[model samples]
Target chain A: MGEENVMSDDILVIAEHDGSNVVDVTFEMLSAARELAKDSGGKVLAAMAGGAALAGSLGAFDRVYLIDDPAVSNYSPEAFEKAFTHVVRDVDPGLVLTSTSTMGLDLAGGLSVAWPAPLVSYVVGLGREGDDVVATSQIYGGKLLAEVVVDSPHAICALIAGSFSGQPSPEAGSPDVETVSLEGIGPSRTSALAVHEPDSGGVDITAADILVSVGRGIGSKENLEIIEELAEALGAPLAASRPVTDQGWLSKPHQVGKSGKKVKPRAYLAFGISGAPEHLEGMRDSELIIACNTDPDAPIFDVAHYGTTVDLFDLVPELTECIQA
Target chain B: MVLLKQLPDLVEELEPSPDGTDIDREFIKFILNEFDDQALEEALVTKESSGAEVIVVALDEPEVDQVLYTALAKGADRAVKLTGVPAGTWVPTHLRAAILAPFVRELAPDLVLTGVQSAEDLDGQLASLLGGYLDLPHAAVVVGLEVKDSIARVVQELGSGRSVEEQITLPAVLGIQAASQAPRYAPISKIRQAMQAGGLEELEAPAPVDSADIAIAQVRIRRLYAPEKSTHAEMLTGDPGEVATRIAEILRSKGLVKA
Candidate 1:
């Protein structure tokens, strides 16, 4: 009974990994959890399924729980949720933190409901205030920031990307890994038939050092050459917003956003891209950001280190000329 | 059935309230959510294929009647306006899902469809929450769906240009990201004709479950504010030549390019 009472105050961080490589968001959640745990006087526990070996590197947590199930080697929402739900029930953590990634969003929705815990998604900030855990989230397409207090005894949160910085734990001690088996988790109502990878013909923008990104304001496919020249002159990769890719002006590999790739280039030159929250979540952490859009009030200006309101059609050729000269 | 919502269009200027808890609604224009429009289009497509009924349910809001009529014009078979939830009130997703579950149960819909996420979604994931309440399987960010023999074959977007195809059992919920094609545009004349036909129905919201009340009380919004701008961007002006020169100079100064 006393051990159960002690476990109730624990904060659980769901570590995301793809069998071999641990996702950066896992470390990011550990950082956020550490801050919250400090104020709440709770221990941070990290949990993962299938990546038992990677658990030892997550020294940030007080304890690490690993669920090894061959059935969960791939990303099955049903299997992962079963493992996570089992861990949550056994540990009874005060707070559960997961990423706002595809898998995270998928698992969080069902888990929050099954646990009957309050869920706060797209969280950008987390803190503790007088016995309550507060989470700040963006709403209205990033125009408004809402401060929400999780009032349930147990709460689950999906943290947005670029909200918190991920740092390895400096505490210099390995986490004790406890392998739990989720055998006989019932059959899933949904079955993943196959995975379709996007056509690979272009540079992967996620690995680019510098990115010249375009959006809807590029107008048409013919105007793409001007930006292409600019990207070539700068020796940077070319990327685009969702609309550009959706229109087939650019391929899926060149798309950068929440639905696309999250990139952290040294410099990101955003042209005609209105900073929607989704797009910003992917490339907001660039070392230097410069945006040029026709609309001065575009949210891209809010995050850009340097910005200009100019028609890209007229501006791109001149900019390319100036660079080439 | 499809779930629709009216949202204050974010394209226009938004001013904060005096208390800074929400946007000032005095001048904001309201429109059907973009994703919900896509969801409606998906439902219409499903109806065409499976001979299913496409019913649109929306909360009572400013100009919502017009939205319902527009959905009708766009090929919805029926429209329902849920009463009792006040307009302009921010209802959390869980409570909204709880309130919607009873109505959905009564409808006995074979499949429930909603937008994957809304522009104003803070706590978000209404379809998933509703699925939980209804004890059904739910899929989010579904880009393609086909219904046959009460089963749904769906293509779910998994971000980073990856997608997964899934076969979900009957009586499931799908959060639509987009349909195979863009939502068809309904001419104003068609909408006017729909309004004249008058197929709109109003249903009073059922009594709230006890859990919904507690959930609402627990989600106390401490404040609402615009995020602080950490960097003051240098806004370049003048002709394209001058701006280009300035950009070149800036780039050269940063050693990103050789002058």
Candidate 2:
């Protein structure tokens, strides 16, 4: 079932920050929002929950709604949702865009239900199909893509990182900034405690010229030693996919994914790692990539410069011996 | 304290139906979602640490009874199946929340936990929607959870290895990203024993009466297809040593491998 297509196509970008600076994803959204604005004819508006200082970076947008609330300044989920809902309810834009990041994931799903809008998430592609908003979402760990049609006048699209090229110009005065207070946010039952940065256990994988990454294909935690030997022979740091770290076989610092760390090493040797979009987002930009997996259809081959359907156990030991020789 | 979902196993090949809305699930192997397994583990761990009763729930499916039995094997106190939703059909996140709301209201537990996401829908959304529907506070991507008195302390994963700790009052919902430890395996004997005991409770509930819940996006999927191969890797056809030597040569040619 679809709704009547009205002309309230103004796009709202829920801008996020690294505490103080506007995030790069916000700019990419602006770039897409610019294209969408042409078709929309309505203005592009960015709602910054607490990003007043970073408003200067959003020159490409038409206007900025600065939710000037202190609770939102620090992200306690309850307060931030209340602050965002307050602005969205008042503005009532047609399309709401946010990144599918840690905070964005919560807001996208929460606000969609709270605002009562339909939401399309894990979106890699976004475009307007006449009156309908078309979104392509990566599902089943990037095994497949779903083409979704948002037949409603108002919708929310949570974009995956790197889906668009967004370079925000650091200029001001393009858009009017409206300062507003929290109108209806209730007392937050949730409160922040402290933040911990993932310790790399003294290894900075991002700085490595060559990264030897392993995925779930490595089999067991005891088998990690084989991959480690290869990394040692190659003079590289050992990195892994989320599953490996989630299993506690390695530290979070050794993780390569959208959530872990983005690395552009001189060479990335992936063993047994199927390239989920999340993992691909982190290491796909390496100078040269070589993938080893048992599955020929593994998506890692799509990004690898050279790939082989070799059993990682067989290939890894041989590769280590060759490197040592 | 725990909710679960069974999803199409990733190991199985997934093919889109001719109509293009969903995958051909008739031949697909169904398994508990990986994150949901972690949710169950977290709930069990919390029960051990904080002295609470752990109840596991899922929508009724042909294979759901086995999953519930497994949960029981892993130390869940009770198992419940909300039945009567058509099998082999898609249930949107909102409807799942709608269906579970009345049951949740009935239990009124201290905390509700579910996987941060499932392959089908809602990456870190199910718990959020459940919280909204039940008018409770919510958090997502929670990697660590600790309950004390009437508060839940959660270690939430932010991007780039950054994590923040947050405390929530009891009777809240959480989208659990992982348990403190990996899910423990249940023995085959225990699973068999739990299944024979047959204490799994069932309640029949159809789709909500106000199904029109007027969502803007109106969650109907249109098509499913594979991503185009914008680039394909050059397959290195050789012995393991030969492929390694070639990889070494390529790295050196790229000026990455130092002599």
Candidate 2 yields a Cα-based lDDT of 0.83
**What is the Cα-based lDDT of residue B247 in candidate 1?**
87
Q: Interface root mean square deviation of every model, in Å?
A: 2.7, 2.1
User: Best DockQ goes to which candidate?
Assistant: 2
lDDT of 2 by residue, B45-67 (tens): 99999889999989986588999
Instruction: Report lDDT per candidate.
Output: 0.82, 0.83
* Deviation in Å, model 2, residue A230 alpha carbon: 0.6
- Flag clash pairs in model 1: none
Per-residue lDDT of model 2, residues A26-116, tens digit only: 9888888778878558788989877677777777788889887777766777887788878888899988888888788677767876777
Model 2 off-target regions past 4 Å? A1-7, A172-174, B122-124, B206-212
DockQ of each: 0.55, 0.66
TM-score of chain A of each: 0.87, 0.95
Error of 2 at A302 (Å): 1.4
